[model samples]
Target chain A: MGLKRNVGLMEALRYQGKGPMLTYILHRIGGLSIVIFVGLHILAGYLANHAWGANLGIFINSIYENWLFQVFIFFFALFHAINGLRIVILDLWPKLIEYQREAIWLEWFVFLPIYGIALFVIVRSGLGG
Target chain B: MKTKQRPAPLGGFNFDYIMWLFTRLSALAMYLIVIVALTGALLMSARQNMSIADLMRWAFMPNPNHVASTNIPDIEVWKTIFWQVMAILMLFFAGAHGLHGLLNVVEDYISSRRIRMSLRALVLVIWVAISLIGITVIVTS
Candidate 1:
């Protein structure tokens, strides 16, 4: 028997292995989110930069200034950036591949706090601080 | 019927292997560009207390603030060129790299070969379109 057939949501959610797939899934999500964000960013940025697009620019700006959107965007960007750096480092030095588990730990431990602080400043300033 | 065995690499060069390599390279470059863009954005926003609309206007237009302060005629020109070039490069590499990675994810998750191929085609088309728009904007700017 090869690939398992037709696993539903609950079945997929139930882990059957020793190693967790959280990071794997996160990496995929991060990549997908960033791509979508980048597309919207380009469209909005272009519109905002246009001569006759002030109203649309304002509309997009209002959305961008939302605290929740900022947090998600920041988190997505940070996660993708840090994890990408890890992958790059490992690829260049395959010997360090063995430390991938640690790399993921370092990614969260070191970067998350940094991002959190940055988020605090951004949100504060964003909200008329 | 679903194919049981993993498909071989696309060609002699190994499409998956090459894409794997390219993804890392492009991702590293993309990360650097994002850092630069983000830092610039944050600084500009904080300095001017700028809304997104204001930021966009300031970015694409000649910087009236800088002109008022520095009285530098070509500074805005250079800044525009720099950001435009950066945007183009970021879009090109990011589009390729992100779509490639997403295609890999599609392959992993989609069991039906037909659907996988179709999704990959869609990703490729969108990526190319976005990249072209990015380049066109930069060129026009």
Candidate 2:
């Protein structure tokens, strides 16, 4: 609502300049990452299962088989979903914006252990044995 | 150079307020959908010992494994219908949420109102186009 605080490309991309700045950057990145994966998932799933072009089924299957890619997806999803809850809470209670730092710390505290467990599960499953 | 101020609020609200409300609502909806969808996949995958690929195949196609394994005779038919509906809904909401985020980014960096508006329009067009294509894939598959 204020006069535009237009920034240069360098400033725009300089998320590492501050703590909250980094969170903002990562939130956008996390959301965008999931969106990208959604597109890929839809297209690949359609190709693999559809009547006209089941030929590409193996190619799509290979992507799911790739452990590295799967890990990346899991992390993106974890960060996005957790942070999104924080955003929703903050939106509902603007007074808690001051506690943003504590919220993020809690988010990371929860994120690390759960992500570790997810990786363990993936590996234990023999990366989809 | 003089700084331009935003026009007075219309009916005690402004564009920023509307956007704020819109973003919050959409974000919450998108988050809930993602959580339900992912949780279902993870639980089912673990129960079935299914790989992601196998899960995808099983979800979209009328696979025998799922059919024979399910308790309810009509569960597969219900599930296929549910998934198809969810898939399209996810595509639309996710696409809108993503484009709105990107639009805010463009607004942050682009000083000119005209340029920002143009970019937002472009983003919306792209989002709609992609959603249409994705919906088509979901329905016809």
Candidate 3:
């Protein structure tokens, strides 16, 4: 049987899957973001080591050093890590699946303070404070 | 009475199952590596002289070259084969985990078997290229 394809992107976005849905979407986004960042990071390191590509490498590194980009990357990295741990825990102990929502709440509780501090530091450095 | 569980189809050796296990294990491995790198940096007094960018680079890969631009007076300690191994480990683990995750995402959107296989091949190529470049840099530097 063929799957139905009536739902569009806008419709899917409007579907409020609440906490589980939000976390699921964010996890995917976070994974993809980290992948992109790591790829570029390795490429930049490779380029920076060579004399011919040194300038290009420096330019890419400068982008990474930008406070705004740092903030975004850090947020995703932190969230992904925390949420991923939650998943592992839940998977290992299936009984905890009943409290998955509470687990996500705990994930945020663990995530926010660390992310807040990192954000503050990034901004402070960016402002030369 | 104990019930006997039937063996799983495909003897539970499916690609999806293997990748799922890999994703979980690799994530934990990366976390351990990062923690080790961070602790090493702290022991070396990274906070006293290293810029955040340099510190971050070292934390992620532990390659001595990443911290070459920092104000650390002696880098000889960081220039060890141990760190080269660490960098290569981080490269392979992160590359494999991240690319596999990407393939999972693509599979979610693309339903065609041919397209999925093609994308898998592409991701594999990209992963190999990244791994080669990363190892070359780590070993040479």
Q: Highest TM-score among the candidates is held by which one?
A: 3
Ranking by DockQ: 2, 1, 3
lDDT per residue as tens, model 2, B45-124: 43455554445334433223333434333443434666677766766666777777777788655656788789989988
**Model 2: pairs clashing at backbone N, Cα or C within 3 Å:** none
**Top candidate, metric lDDT:** 3
Q: By DockQ thresholds, what CAPRI class is model 1?
A: acceptable
- List the candidates ranked by lDDT, beginning with the highest: 3, 1, 2
Q: Where does candidate 2 chain A have its weakest 10-residue lDDT segment?
A: A1-10
Q: Give the C-alpha interface root-mean-square deviation per candidate.
A: 4.5, 4.8, 13.4
True contacts kept of 1: 0.33
lDDT by residue (tens digit), candidate 3, A36-68 = 888887788889888999999889889987888
User: Alpha-carbon error at A70 in model 1, in Å?
Assistant: 0.7
- Summarize candidate 2's per-residue lDDT along A1-129 as a digit string, tens digits: 555444556766764667566667778777777666666665665566666767675476577667887788777777877787888898799999999989988988988998898788777776565
Question: What digit string (tens of lDDT, one per residue) describes model 1 on residues B1-141?
Answer: 333455444545677778888888887776677567656655544345545434433433222332233323344443566776776676678788888878888887787778988998998888877777666645655
Per-residue C-alpha lDDT of model 1 across residues A5-104, encoded as one tens digit per residue: 5556776778664222666677778888877876765566556667797578658757766877878876776777777788789888999989988887
